[model samples]
Target: MAHITLPDESLPGIVGLFNFRPETTGALQLIAETLLRGESSLTSGERELIAAHVSYLNNCHFCHTSHASAAMAHLECDLSLIDDIKQGFNQIEISPKLRALLNIAGKVQKSGKEVKESDIEAAREQGATDREIHDAVLIAATFCMFNRYVDGLGTWAPQENEAYREMGQRMAFTGYVRYAEADL
Candidate 1:
């Protein structure tokens, strides 16, 4: 059960939070739009992977599954790579730049201050541009906040993986802007 009364119980996780704080949904969507969907050195899939990784680290099942599905949708390859990333990126077959960026993201999930100059340097050395590093950090930090927001509210989350895959297809097709209206 949710910690507060919402307009509907069917709206799961952050969707319920969005409906509860209807005013912030647009702004939140804008942020997500900018970070995950906007043009950047990082592909939409890569950005979503970073988000999914952070959610996994935070143990936020709703976000982990949602972003993982979205990541897979945006990618050209099979979903197993994403599954490996969620488990741990180190042993997975991913780019060195991505690995570096994931390292930084993991650090940020622990604490923003935990991210150091060395981390930034490492990413750059691995071919991550300044913009990529910035975006990765932002994505990590944002997801951490988002994860807490959902869990802190004791929001209901669907356990079924199929729901997440459906959500991913819709999100990949339409983006976050439409989600608030269609779902909430």
Candidate 2:
């Protein structure tokens, strides 16, 4: 059950919240589309991974699972990769640039102040451009707020992975703008 009576209680996580306040959905969806689905040096998968990582750190189950599935869809990989990310990036075979960005994201999850000059240098050394680093930080910071929004409202999330997988496919293929437009 949610903390308040949403317009569609059956809808899970942020979707239900979006229904509760239709006016805000466009802006939220635009942010998501631009960050996750927009053109950038970072692939959609990498951005989704950063989102999943921040959600995981926040212990926001809905955000974590949904974004993880999206990441899986973009990467065309299995759950094991998501597991590797959750376990920590050190042992994974991901690109050094991604790992460095993830490190920056993890620090952002803890506190904006936690990110250091050395972290930026390390990411730069790994060939992360200023834009990529900026995106990573913004994604991390945004997801932190988003995670809190979902969890704070006591929105319910489906436990089954299949539900998230379906959502991931839709998000990966259609993107957020289309969904947001439909809602308007």
Candidate 3:
């Protein structure tokens, strides 16, 4: 159970649904879908990885578990890689560009002021376009806000692995932004 009462359907909004209101939940849901869940120039798996890493740094268990599951589904990798990423993607076998992006994301999670020019230069050297770097920073910064929101409110997470797996599978297709079909 959540620390505060909220409608079941609006639970996914995390902090945005704290007041048990509809308008705030709807708006936040739209942003989550468009930014985190939708197709972007960056791969879904990579974006989810960024989100998970930032959440991990922020110590937001709900975001970490949820996005980690989504990343696993999209990357088609074993759970070990997820653990590896949670530990330190810096040593993981991802592309240099991705490593650079993850580095930038890490800084964003720590503090936006800490993101240095050297980070950009490293990513640029790895063939990351400015847009990719920009997106990475944005994803990291946004996830920091999200992590605080979920943790601050003490949002309840679904306890079962099956539920997260099913959500991950569905999100690999539908993304974070799209609302469930009427039948759902």
Candidate 4:
């Protein structure tokens, strides 16, 4: 159970936050859509991975699992890939550009100031665009706030991983901004 009584059980994990402050949903969705689903060189899977990574660093269980499932659904849904990413993307054999961006995201999760010009340059040299780098930073920063928000309130998060599969599929099919087909 959350620190406060939520509206309903349908709203699981961080989604329950909306119960207390429904007004913020619109704004939050806008940012999520723009950063996670907006046009960019980086794929939606990659963006979700960044969010998951930041959540992992923050030790926010709900955000990490939920976003990891979303990332997996968007990509190949490769459990191995998601596992490797959560563990440490550096050890994986992903693209150098992605690795660089993940590195920067990790830094941002710790402290936005930790991101250096050299990190940006490295991402650029590895073929990441300015928009891609910018998106990664924003996603990291946003998830940091989200993680804290979810954990700060001592909100309820379903313990089972299977619980997020449905939500992940919903997000993958209908973009975050689209509500008609999405249970989210």
- Model 2 — TM-score against the truth? 0.93
The per-model lDDT (C-alpha) reads 0.84, 0.89, 0.75, 0.81
lDDT of 2 by residue, 1-184 (tens): 9999998899999999987887887889889999999989999998998999999999998899889888889888775565666688644457999989999999999999999999999999999999999999999999999999999999999986666888988888788874545565
Write down the RMSD of all candidates, one decimal each: 3.0, 2.0, 3.9, 3.1
Worst 10 residues of 4 by lDDT: 175-184
By TM-score, the candidates rank as 2, 1, 4, 3
The CA lDDT at 173 in model 4 is 66
The C-alpha stretches of model 2 lying farther than 4 A from their native spots are 90-92, 179-184
Q: What is the per-residue lDDT of model 3 for residues 1-184, given as tens digits with 9 covering 90 to 100?
A: 5566666644553643644764455555665666666657788888888888888888877788778778888888755555676678744457889889999999998899999999999999999998899889988988888887787777767654455676677666776544443312
Error of 4 at 69 (Å): 0.7
Candidate number with greatest lDDT: 2
Pick by TM-score: 1 or 4, better one: 1
The candidate scoring highest on TM-score is: 2
Error of 4 at 93 (Å): 5.8
What would the TM-score be for candidate 4 when compared with the true structure? 0.88
**Candidate 4 runs further than 4 Å off:** 90-93, 178-184
